[model samples]
Target chain A: MNDVIICRCEGVRLSEIEQAIREGASAVPGVKKRTRAGMGPCQGRVCQRVVLQLLQQPPSEAGESPDALQRSRSPVRPTLLGDL
Target chain B: MNDACDVAVVGAGPAGLVAAIEAARAGLSVTVVDEFPWPGGRLLGQLYTDPRSHGRWDGRKISRQLAQEAGELGVRILGGATVWAVGRDLSLELSGVPVGTLRPQALLLATGAAERALPVPGWTKPGVVCVGAAQTFTNVHHVAIGRRVLVAGIDPLALSVAMEMHHAGVDVAGVVLPPVSTTSGALASPERAVARLADVADLAPNGLLRAAARLAAGKLSPLAVSALRFDLVRVGGVSIGFRTALVAVEGDGRVESATLRSVAPDGTLVGPERRIEVDAVCISAGLYPLTDLAEIAGCPMVEVEELGGLVPLHGPGLETPLERLFVAGNLTGIEGAKVAIAQGRQAGCSIARSLGRATLVSPEDAARAVSDARTSSPFRFQPRIAAGRAAMAELWQQAIARGDQSA
Candidate 1:
């Protein structure tokens, strides 16, 4: 409970996200690029929502809402080879 | 069986099966598309004796019955159809290499509910899964989820799955409620917690009732006392760690153990933290109706926490704001299988009434079908569910009315 691990797949902590935001990560993609929070096996299925909640605060609230930011990505599911 | 169908039903769960049956019986050409390789949805995996009657409910039988009825009525069932997207134009984007299109006169979304992710620390591990996933592995695939399991919750899903796992000879370490101190501590609310615990007794009340009858001058029945224990409830016959909240899951490569810390009702840590070594963890909060297809179809949605989350606003007959696009079952709200079946019948009749040129299923007949199917089960949670639905509908109406005024 003390040390909360948000991104379980990659073992990324909330502190890491906060640090990424402090390090000039503006939006979800920026935080993702810096922290690798949503680039795990589940493909952000679990952490995307958590990342959205984390990005709702100050400094990261510059551009579009977190809802719109999360929705901007395509291929929502793990696309199979046949789907291509 | 063609690309053009009178009615297209998505997700061949109980609701979709019922909807397809009703529509096809009413002489509408029906097409049921499901992502599963087979029908039955979650019902296939829920193999347990009904707590009320102590009679084993073969969910497969009824599912097969509905599937048979749909087939008999000439309903084309595409078991492995993965609908990538659904459009307001009543056309569907198929899965895998751009398959053919489906343009039905009407669409029924029986997409049902997804197991709500209980995002705790270490949940993204390999062996940590939801109860529904555990049940599917055991019941559908006949594969054991794990040799030893830790279930994190005490609701109907947790209790039932624990019992099922125990029956399958999988060692159920315990069923524990999430710590009240946690952020997702809705169980700390007296009303919600009481309702949840009362539901435990309501599940297997016969043992409680018989024990009560044997009580000496209204004394606490020891038999009832032990039977109502978290460990003893629902023939689970496993350990139950009360006041325990899963804080983290620890494992080397796969899931190895879960950390359970006890907390008081006021969100205060009360006791020592205990670590239960286990291979699998079945974490469950509740089920939320999947509304992606409904949203893709541009149906107006409102967040209803009672139904597990955001749900499409619809009329009594399951017709969404976007007409010709109906939703049934848990896709509307997370009630239960019986309610879903009734709503599916209602949707089928409604779709037939609106879309069919010469129909056999009338509105009155549909209404009767829904009513008849709704009250047969002595389900105790229906009252709370009804209240939740009423509140949700009220909120939806208020939102709509405000939009009218502003417009």
Candidate 2:
């Protein structure tokens, strides 16, 4: 197993995310708040694919089709803070 | 205090900033409302560390300067105020509550753009993130997200984040795309981008070496690998884990884990479910115009196939169907900052002229200048943007379906 960085803005690696999962971050937003992954400049535009790949399959059934999940709020690209 | 202005600009990005500045300079009592504590909109505090050199700048500084000049011209700037809804009468709701209405002689919608969400299996996972979010965290708060990160998409914003992460001492794994080159226009020519990357490598040998090293190191750490059980493949020194066995993405609002049926390339269900752990995930699918306010204000909008959804169909004057309501910036389309500024300035001049303000430059002259300015902007990524929108629609549909099934 190699360390995979899923979100570049927050510097979150797959390993650390899995660790967070092991440590009981049961949901995406939960892990995000704890690790600060999707909370960066481009929002979550960079590491989303990796997150989906890593979090594939729950503990029970492997063949269960992955369900599509939606973000509670849409992420917008960061503008100049002053401009906002 | 109940005050009147010749022009009321909503938002303070390049569009609103320029609008207020130009209009006030033209002797209009301009008032600009922004949701942030200061001006600059998304450009301020958005971190973009130079990929070739980890250089930083406070985006707010530029906006501050513009604000200063506008202030000197007597433009009323209202920061820390949210314009929730804009009405046809040019009345604005502040923070979902009713505020005093300002029926300015003219109004400009510089509402900018918002990020488009693309749904994917496990996209709701805990570590999944957005490119804009990551930039905000790093640039605004001076916080680092994670040690290793993976960027998706190929937009300049996506590349900028990867470069920023690398410069911020974060290990950027690699950028992933949906088996297609979405960006195909002036945004960045594929050949030119590759050449620029080469230039970046030449300029920042260390960044290039680190990117090379990360690419070469196939697979993530054993802990992440074992926990996630992702199928890994090495490509050009980068370890790419393809989740072929994705069945369904599940989470309680926030993403916890996804269900995999079979790995891709060949669809075969992997028996027994396994969870891949991650801290954050960033998604940069595409961008959409923030046209809600424009729509509310009764602007004559048309769906531009090449420019994503609902863009204002303004003629040379930047005037909407509403005589006093003008639209500019990304609210019309996802053009670059320079174009947005130019459009805003032109709109300001047009509004000023309509108010009979005599100036050295005529509205036609300003329009010509705006047209010239727009010609040089590097925002011709219509194809890629369309693809990104399509992808986002797919994701949204999938999510809705999943939500219905779960319910």
Q: TM-score, each model? A: 0.80, 0.60
List candidate 1 segments past 4 Å from native: A1-12, A16-76, A80-84, B51-55, B96-99, B179-183, B188-194, B203-236, B357-383, B395-407
Q: Residue by residue across B267-339, what tens digits does model 1's lDDT show?
A: 3555677798899988876666776677777776665555555677776667776769888988877766777
Off by more than 4 A, model 2: A1-84, B45-58, B96-99, B178-277, B378-407
Cα-based lDDT at residue B315, candidate 2: 47
Which CAPRI quality tier does the interface of model 2 achieve? incorrect
Q: Which ten residues in a row have the lowest lDDT in candidate 1 chain A?
A: A59-68
Model 2, span B43-83: residue lDDT tens:
77444333334554346666778788888999888887666
Second chain TM-score per prediction? 0.85, 0.69
Question: What is the C-alpha local distance difference test score of each model?
Answer: 0.67, 0.57
Which residue pairs in candidate 1 collide? B179-B245
Please give the distance, in angstroms, between residue B261's alpha carbon in candidate 2 and its true position after superposition. 12
